[model samples]
Target: MEVNNRYITITNHIQGSAKESDFELKVVPLRLSVEPGSSAVILKNLWVSIDPYQLNRMKRYSSSHKTVQPAVRITPGQPIDSPGVARVLVSDDPEFVKDDLVEGFVHWGEYTVVKGGMLRKLDPEIDLPLSYHAGVLGMSGLTAYAGLFEICKAKKGDKVFVSAACGSVGNLVGQYAKLSGCYVVGCAGSRDKVALLKEKLGFDDAFNYKEETDLNSALARYFPDGIDIYFDNVGGEMLEAAVANMNTCGRVAACGAIAEYSEGAKRAAPNMVDVIYKRIKIQGFLAIDHMSLHSDFLSTTTDYIHNGKIKVQEDISSGVESIPSAFIGLFRGDNIGKKIVKIADE
Candidate 1:
């Protein structure tokens, strides 16, 4: 007789606004054992992170470029997934053994069987919350570090701009820029978040995008001389305005396009004309592109946290069933910081 497993699956390719009903909760019988020759691991999920990038996997890849992990397809009635942290219950490889804590390509279920390269060991003595590894010290932190430091190449006294400034990456980016001696400004969707950016995140200036009718003018007011470096997240009209306001030889790190994730529309039609006029350099980057820097990022961020030079905020929702509501909130700017869902607290 096989064991029964519980998991969450997608019901359809949500075209418009996503609703909770699109997810299907199921329980089925399966063998949970991993043998020595299997070259796989059996893990019990501890936490799961819901990020904006997952929206890309949900839709059709319009481009000819092969999707990352082209072999893994997200289809109807399949288990919904993302990077997650879990504990190894069984292992077949020499690198891991039973009861080892790990994190990687864990899905929406309670348990997963994945290969070695798909998982990594977690530090047990850190004394910080383990759920934090699913975020601040995890992929989100790496995204913030690689996107801001590596791509932007921010210098001291330079003017830096961050869109979605109060987000997980944005908040950290602003702080890092400040530490790097840059004059930083951030834009957020709400008034409260703007205030938090200034008061808590230590940004030099901040404003509410919802209150501004003309982003171009708004940017002009904050960056009177033009922006030297822009850490872009929301890519629609914001990119257009920022591009229009860049100084000579300005640099932009295109971190993400969350504004288009839900709407799936491109508003800022590549203003390369602006790039030529201002001699600006804007580049799109993925954290996976700089995987070699992950270890350096983790070590630096750990030191920053320990020395009290940096801080991270998170908005966590408990339970696997909360994935839909948590993910749906991102489109509405309903989350304050890093939005994560806890599959199992233990």
Candidate 2:
């Protein structure tokens, strides 16, 4: 059967902060079947993730930065893609069959045709929200796991500080640190998120960075002894403050810099003197690079969620049309945990 698929596409290469006007919803005809023996699958998108990293992809190509290069530069009139949870409508591949739920890089559309790549089949036996595969159980979860445990080398009793604490990755990092017996402090943009961090996520303490006049003082109050591990998501003033208050030989996991995505050349300049004096180790990483640890992350985090040890929050916007607004909301800190758009139901 042929179906009309609505997908989000970039109107143009974004120059500054992204706006809903920058994206347009376009419809195209989709064939439900692929040629026999072709290694391709037709996917009906269930949930699509709205991530800050995608904002970098909207920009016109320039100097390559290790942290925020777009996986594929978005063309002005092409469908944009992101990691999401989807259900197979038709398959010409042996690995996937019709109705098989899968997760992989999918377009911001109701339906997509995936030609090749590793598409993971979801285990129906694991009783959890399938949308989670787009967030905590997906890249965001792996990001938090690898960034904290692998990059930060976080240990029990360590004083851990997380920026963007209530975000997809930060929330998990804080919870994981707490589970490991660390004193965890998280900083968010609002009081509600701060409360979510402290009360819901079990963060040792939480602060609203927007309310603080001096970030350095705020960190000092949170960590009197200095932060032993810093899981940095919002890199800019927060990173500078965290560095200023870092303990000797502190480990910093540079997961993201949402603050610098639209700033161009006017990015935050962290204090290098603290890095030199305190002998801090800052490591930036991509979750994809740490795929070897995926098994452990899934096993450990799933067990935590199933056992009530880890709590997760999802900010879900309904419909494929909500994609643009949801994506733009990330920079405004409009989301609490994982931000995603629900396109359809199973």
Candidate 3:
């Protein structure tokens, strides 16, 4: 049988903010049958993650060019791929079968053709919303788990701070710290998000970074004892400020720097002296490097969600057409928790 493909693709090279014009809805005529030398599977996509990390991919900008350098580049004519959730329609491999729900580097399409090591069957007993498997239970979940616990190596009663606290990965990081008995505080871009953090997400304290004229002062006020662990999501000034506020022997997990994603050049934020004075240890990690520990992440996060130790919020946008609006909204701090666009439901 043949498959049909209809998904979002980049219309052209982008200079600034991504517009709907930057993406075109295209249909690819798919042939489901794999060639004898090939092992490919057919996937009917359900939900897709609109992550900040994706913005880095849109640019014609590269090290050779003048705009944002590509940590991961997406060409102007290809489908936008991210960690997404899908149900298998057909497979030529022994590892997958029809009707298996999975997650991986799937394209922004109703149907996708992918090879091995890129799709995973989601656990059915999790009682999770389908989109949760794409965000919290998928990439975002592993990100927070690896960034906080694995790299940071947090301990009980430690003071932990998370930047961009209301988004997908930040929300989970704060919740995990709280569950692990850490004094968790988060700084967000707005007062509404601050309220959501403290009230809905149960952070120990939350501050609006936009309202704070001096980030250094805000950190001093919130972490009166100084931060012992910092889970960094938005770098630049926030990272510099967090460093200055670290207590002796503090740990910092350098995750994604969404603030610098669209910008060119590596500009160092002020305050490197703290690293020397406080004997701080900061480490940068790619979640891909920690894929070996995914089962452990799922196990721990699953138990927490099941037992109510953690709460996950998903900002769901229905239909594939909503991808551009949802993706653009992320830059404006429009999403509360994880932002996922539901393409279809099975």
The prediction achieving the highest TM-score against the true structure is 2
Q: Give the TM-score ranking, best first.
A: 2, 1, 3
- Cα deviation at 259, candidate 3, in Å, is 1.3
- lDDT score at residue 303, model 3, on the 0-100 scale: 90
Please write out the lDDT profile of model 1 over residues 131-182, one tens digit for every residue: 7788888877888888878887888988999998888788888988898899
TM-score for each predicted model, relative to the true structure: 0.94, 0.96, 0.93
Candidate 3 structure quality by residue, lDDT tens digits, 1-346? 7656788878877666767778888887887666654678878888898887777677776552333222467877677778899988878878888888888878887888887647777878878777888988998999899988889997799999999899999999999999899999998888899999998889999998888889988899999999999998888888888898899999999887877766563544746687888889889887778988999999899898888888888898998888888998888899999999999976
| Cα RMSD of predicted structure 3 | 2.7
Tell me which residue pairs clash in candidate 2. Answer: none
**Which RMSD values do the candidates have, in order?**
2.0, 1.6, 2.7
Which candidate wins on lDDT? 2
lDDT of each: 0.81, 0.89, 0.84
Residue-pair clash count for candidate 2: 0
Model 2 alpha-carbon miss at residue 194, Å: 0.8
Error of 1 at 101 (Å): 1.5
